[model samples]
Target chain A: MKRSVLPTIAHRLAILCYIAFALFPLFWLLKVSVTPNDLLYSEGVRLWPSRTTWDHYAFVLQHSAFPTFFKNSVIVAASTAVVVTICASLSGYALSRFSFRAKYLIVALMLLTQMFPLVMLVAPIFKILSPLGLTNSLTGLVIVYTAFNVPFATFLMQSFFDGIPKDLEEAAMIDGATKFIAFRQIILPLTLPGIAATLGFVFTAAWSELLFALMLINGNSAATFPVGLLTFVSKFSVDFGQMMAAGVMALIPAALFFLLIQRYLVQGLTAGAVKG
Target chain B: MRKPWLKRLAHASEPWLYSAPSLILIIAVMLVPLVVGISYAFRDIQLLNPFSGGFIGIEHFRDLAKDAAFYTALKNTLWWTGASVILQFFFGLFLALLLDKPFWGRGLVQALVFLPWAVPSFLAGLNWAWLFNPVIGPIPHWLFALGLMDQPGNILSDPRHAMWGPIVANVWWGIPFFAITLLAALQAIPRDLYEAASIDGANWFQRFRSITLPFLAPTIAITVLLRTVWISNFADLIVVMTGGGPADRTQIVASYIFTQAFKRLDFGYASAIALVLLVLLLVYSMLIILLRQTLLNKD
Candidate 1:
């Protein structure tokens, strides 16, 4: 049976609409970031600015506390990503391969942890951190973010580990390698895509997290970019140009981070789309 | 290698070793705090000296029973989750179906559609806030030019429209995940099945209802479940957009918890609220599992 052209046309039209809907806001962000401050309010409804400048970007980078916030955010997010991936990989491999007595209970408990809303635990978390003088510090934020992100990351890594065949590891073990050696030398190398995907996912999540960062850190020096973005909005008026510029600037690291791992990300997305 | 006692010990101990790091981190950071939170919920703990307070049993729970803000937050949270998940899934499924076929620029379109998922949610919320600005935002301006609104700020300021702004933003951000997941599921449907349907003279709608819908149901159910959990926990966007404001009309449970804990420093009361949310989510997940089991049994 031949497919009809009308249905194909309709299908393409629908997709085109979705693409526009999704990308419109991002395009708007890029547009407003370049628009001159004076024209932000004056030119009411223009898609493209009449004139553009890098003034807001320059001012946000040079004059504001954004750079510090960016640096702190990088430290916190990167550390959390590395920490969570390291933890999750070991657990995920165990969950995938082992049949320990408490395996079922452990998986259930991890799922239970994911069920609780983060908001509910905020006070208890703060109380626990404050006594150790961990509150108002990047390390505290990293610890909290890592805890919150690990459960989901573990599940993510577990799925990846499950996808890889057990034959390879069994073969490695038979060749006189210990189980640890089999995992480290044989399985770990094969899981580079999973590691990259997990790292990217966890990094982006911690990078954009605002609640813990806002609650745990109070001062400008330790604030992450999300909290710093709030500084652009005062009680009186919002600095649209500056905020948009900062927003654009904040996209750089995450964008670069993703660009570096796009190969893995693409592979990760498509890896399980079809059966091997 | 064949020593049974040593092998059993190794097998038993290996899991513990493998899972120890995750277990310790979760226990220290997640489970301990959760247990402490439950204890605090029964106490009258202040932020300054959380350990100093004596346990008041269910006093905080009783207080929450009469709290109007708590009820409002709960209601708003339900509204947020229901609206966000339903809209995102449907729109995402629609897009996935549309894009399942071969077409020109399909790869570019898929990339563009998935762009929102790539951008951070905080920035997306910020961008939407600017877009909805009454005087300066192009959206309101466009609405006014089309005679759809009398003024610019009404949408963001009005209680009725406040929640919708964040919902729209969330839906925009979420559609991509559903699209990608559903597209993956759609592609997995064997081409031979579709061809067989076409041979039977089934039209597009008939083919979808007879074959596509049934095959995609499991994936769709899982997607909906995941989306529900995620959207229910979504407070960051609301925090940026309305701060649960315009008279707390948009105060979802997550944002409310943030304010109660951080702003008010009422650790005990906040913990009680958080416990209630945890219970709700558990119940929701259980319900989904039951429904999924029943659906599978029907087949």
Candidate 2:
């Protein structure tokens, strides 16, 4: 019996169409970033501009507050990811292994956190932080971000821990290792991929956060990349090329990080979403 | 030999010790402020006004009741959330199915496709905005050349269809989420079921209905719930693309709250609107979960 090859061709064609749609905006961003200012309007709507230069990137680096924003974002997102991961690893382990009295309540609390509009917190957080001088501070952003991300990261990590067999730790306990030691020495090593996935997920989330950063941070000194970019867009609305260059720059670290960890992310989700 | 009381105490607290840090942070940062934020609705707390912190019960809500803008925003949120979620889910499911099938270079294709999810929401918003720009963007020109538009106007500026701009951008960014989760769910389905179905003379649609749909139901339900909540609260794209304008056509409840708080600096009013939204969302989530439970019981 012979099967027609039409289905396979159709599938490939459909996939290619998706790929084109997915990458088109990024392609446009890159294209405009390279196109010099003089030719920006003259060669408007061109897929590939006639002439290109790196001047926008050069100026954004030298003339803008973007580097400060970049540095602040790195600090905020990195710290939040690390802190959340550490907290989540422990809590996730508890959720996976323990049937404590508060387990249901804890799960419910996390679910409640997920349900509410975070915009509610803006006013209160600012009011609470202003007296203590946390508003407009990177430390404040990290604390708030860490809290916001913890619930989700904990859930994701719990799923990972669930995927890990209980027998390995049981074996370690039989060899006279305590729970913490066994967790540290045996199960933790096994969960490196999950940890990496958590870190990457939280990092991307913290990096992309805008409303909180916008509300909390005041000036270039503590402003994250999002705040800086929005300010740039509104203040210098005409400089599309430069703004696109900065935008492209912002895309690089996250795109690279997600690209590197996406495999483990999928693997982690395999143990996560499909299960519970 | 009996263990020491201290050791027993430590053992009893093991899970608590593991969970303490997260619990503490969530309460201090989230729960405490959530209560405080809820109270901010009953009291005035303007940022720029030093004397604005005063008890003003029900006034904001009364204003919100009368505020036509808030009602319009409420309607817009429904449209935005409903359209974006449905479109994203279907597209995501399609992509998941496509990726689930074995093909050459599937890995590269996935990375490229999922790349947008990694892009910061801010940039995703701005990039889409740029795409809709009449000058220096091809979308308008393409639309015009295709005769869909007479003059290639940015639909983001067109009040009647402005919401579609952000909805399209949202769909583009969010499809990967559903795709990823569904793809994971797809992979988890036992392969033998399909094999068995084929042997029993089940066609593609029959196999999918019997095996795939049943397996994917739990995931679909959960993702749809999560995405509905998340997307309803998601104000980034709307804020960036329209800033709640071309006459507040695309202003969602979340964005409206943000505008009230950030732009208007009206903490009391923003919190009031937020409280209403929170209540509404809580109701919606409860309904869905209860529905899921009833369906599961039937199953």
Candidate 3:
């Protein structure tokens, strides 16, 4: 079939427009972060400033508590991702493979978790964690994030597991391997893409979470990126350059992780949405 | 003692063992807190006041009944969720369709367009907030240049238009999600079906209506339903951008709950508000499910 040139051009233009819309804000973010403070107001609407400096980034990294926030966020988000992925993998494997008594109940509970406002749990969780001394701790953030993420990650991993043929594991089991061994040695190798996707998803989620972090963590010592940045914003509202620099730094890890796993995420989402 | 009963029991319990850790976490962190949170709604549980953890009955709810701020927030939640979801869905659907047809550099374009989703919600809020800031951001200047306003000013500070700031940010961040999902569903539609439709003299819109719509109906329904519920509960943008400010114009139930708990340290009142939001969401979900059921039954 011969495609019309006009339609093709129009389609390309539309895609370009969408791409620009998506990237413009991020571009502006980068733009303002590097612009010299003296020129910020004068060249407010310029697509690109004639001259730019990295002083803002330097100041944020050197003079601010952002490094601590960055490290804390890495610890919390990485720990939560690892823990959530482990729990999700096991539970997801069961849901994909087994016909158990509590299967429906488990599904129902997970769905219920998704349905309600997570904000509802804030007060109770704080109250519960305070006595245990988990508040203001990275471990507490990890635990809460792990639980909040597991349900969706389980669903995601389940869909990926479903994509793999059951015959592969069945064959392993027939060779005198326990079901667990078969799953470990045979199935897991096949689901590496899924695992990567889940890790990325949960990592991004834990990284970006704002309210709970704001509520639980108190001082700059324990504050995650969101909390620290927000505090910085409120305190130094006029330091747009430094704030944008911090924001740009925060975007790096999540964006890199996302670009890596987005393919599998879309694939898994399709499998779950289409087949289920 | 290699007993058959023991083996049978282990076989039956295998899945449970595998699921136990996650189950324990969920019960401990989410389920227990949920129950305790519900209990909190019926009691007085201020964080600062040592004498405030008493049973308060429905007094909080009675106060909620007359709270003008609560009503504004409730109304804003509907508007925020509705506008954000609809805008995201349509723009997302358009982008998905555009990407569905293979093009030069499609992979690169897809990644570029979906990059916004990777941004932390807080960062997205702050980024948009910066854009709307008149001093450093360009949006206000653009709006002014277009004669939409008399001078460059922060939209985030304008009570009448404050909600749109977050809504716009949300749409930008959320569009990629719908696009990715819808694009997947679009690709799943059989190519031959489109060929046959075209051969039968059906035009693009007809093909879309008859073929694409049906293929995408289930996904559309599910995503829309889920997004509506999720977006209503999403308050990070509002909190970060406006803090529900300009006299609480952009406050939603979720942000209102946060305000009560975090700022006021009124855990009980926050829980009370959260409980009401939860109930309203449950009703909304039930209605959607019932509507889906009746539609299925009709067919």
Candidate 4:
């Protein structure tokens, strides 16, 4: 079969176009963040600015409330990731290993959770949390984020668990090890990629959550990155350089985690889809 | 000593014990709140007024029935969801097909193309809003140069064009999700199938129509349906970019719900509107399921 050069060029061109479209926004973000304030308007629409500076980054870090927001977001997202991963691993293992009667019911409930609008829960959750002193706190955000993330993470972990051979855990159990010990010592180490993928996914999701965070947390002391950035944007609408600098900082952890675990994430999704 | 019945009980309870933490969390944080939220639709629950919590008995729904803004938001939701879903799906499918073929620098290309999904929704919104701004952004200037606009003006403030700003941003952000899933499904198709098709003298379109389409049908159906529902509920871009401004032109039901709750501080009305949106979504989902069932039955 003679391969045509035309199709190959077209394919490469299409991929390049897609890549440009995807990264153009982030590139613009980076460009504007580094652009000096005076040049932001004068050099508008230029691919690169004539002059650039780190002054905006310094201002956001030193003068703004963004550091507190960043710290709070990191705490909430990391805690949610660790907590959701632990719970999902146990539940996902059970689903992969057992054929219990309520299994179908459990699956249905999780699916239901995925389908409905979560915005509906804002008022009720606020009502419930306010009295308990959980509202306006990072602890409340972690708890809420963990619950919101568990179902999807559980399904993800289940698919990963399904890919592994049951015999590894069974053999360990047969050697007088408890099932929990087998899962901890033998199986857990093997599923590190899956665990990493789950952590990354949940962390990104928790980091990005806005509406609930905005609704529940009021003060800047407990505000997550999204709430803080939104407030900053509204308050200082003219400070494009500073806001873009903050936006660039917000993208770092999520992007790093995503680039690391994206391969496993797609693989896990494929496994789940085939089973369904 | 442990008896056989006690051992049997432990065996039966093992999965339950494993699932208990997640189940409890879901019930406490999600399920209980959902029930309370549904209840809120009937009661007058004002955020600031302590004495406002009372059974109003369908009063909010009645007010909602007459509200013109609610109706406009409902219409906007359909337009927003439809445009975003269709554009994302086609672009995503094309990208997936392009990536599926072996090419140089494929890994790097894949990483770069999917980077948009990794950006937080709020930031994506702001980034796009800035892009459309005439002062610091380039999009309006480009539009002016292309003669698509009278002058370099921000579309985010234009009632007629405001919706497109968020829609474009959404399509850019969401394409990667569809591509990733479709790409996974594409890879799962056996390579031999394509080889055999080529041997049969089938052209690319014929092969794609007969082989690729059938192989990807289940995935396409599931992903498209899910994306439609999800996009309809997604208001982050709209909320962040326009704040549903310029006379509520970009306001979808989701953003409307946020406005009512956050700005008006009227929790009951917000819950009422949310309940209606929820019911509409359920109906839509049921219709899709039924349609799928019938298609399956015919086969």
Pick the DockQ winner.
2
Q: Please report how far candidate 4 places residue B128 from its true position, in Å.
A: 0.7
User: Candidate 3 residues B232-272, lDDT tens each?
Assistant: 98988988899999898999998998888888989899989
Clashing pairs in 1: B134-B152
What's the TM-score of each model vs. the native?
0.86, 0.91, 0.88, 0.87
Q: Output DockQ, candidate 3.
A: 0.56
True contacts kept of each: 0.66, 0.78, 0.76, 0.65
lDDT per residue, candidate 2, A32-125, as tens digits? 9999989998898878988889999999999999999999989999899999999999999999998878898998788789888898887678
Cα lDDT tens digits, model 3, A166-241, are: 9889998889899999999988866665787678768888999987898789988999999988888888988888
Q: RMSDs, each prediction? A: 3.8, 3.2, 3.8, 4.0
Where model 3 places Cα greater than 4 Å from the true spot, the runs are: A1-4, A96-101, A159-196, A262-276, B1-8, B184-218, B291-299
Clashing pairs in model 3?
Answer: none
User: Could you tell me the TM-score of candidate 2?
Assistant: 0.91
Cα deviation of A75, candidate 1, in Å: 2.6
Model 2 residue A20 CA deviation (Å) reads 1.0
Could you tell me which 10 consecutive residues in candidate 2 chain B have the lowest summed lDDT?
B181-190
- Candidate 1 — which residues are off by over 4 angstroms? A1-8, A130-133, A161-196, A267-275, B48-52, B95-111, B144-153, B180-223, B293-299
Per-residue lDDT of candidate 4, residues B1-299 (tens digit): 57998999999999999999999999899999989988989999888999999999999999999999999999999999999999999999999999888676666677778888878899999899989999888899899999999999999999989999999999999998788767766765667888999999999999999899877776677677767888888888998899888898999999998888888899888989988988898788767767766766765
Local error of candidate 2 at residue B287 (angstroms): 1.4
Off by over 4 Å in 2: A1-4, A130-133, A162-196, A263-276, B1-12, B190-203, B295-299
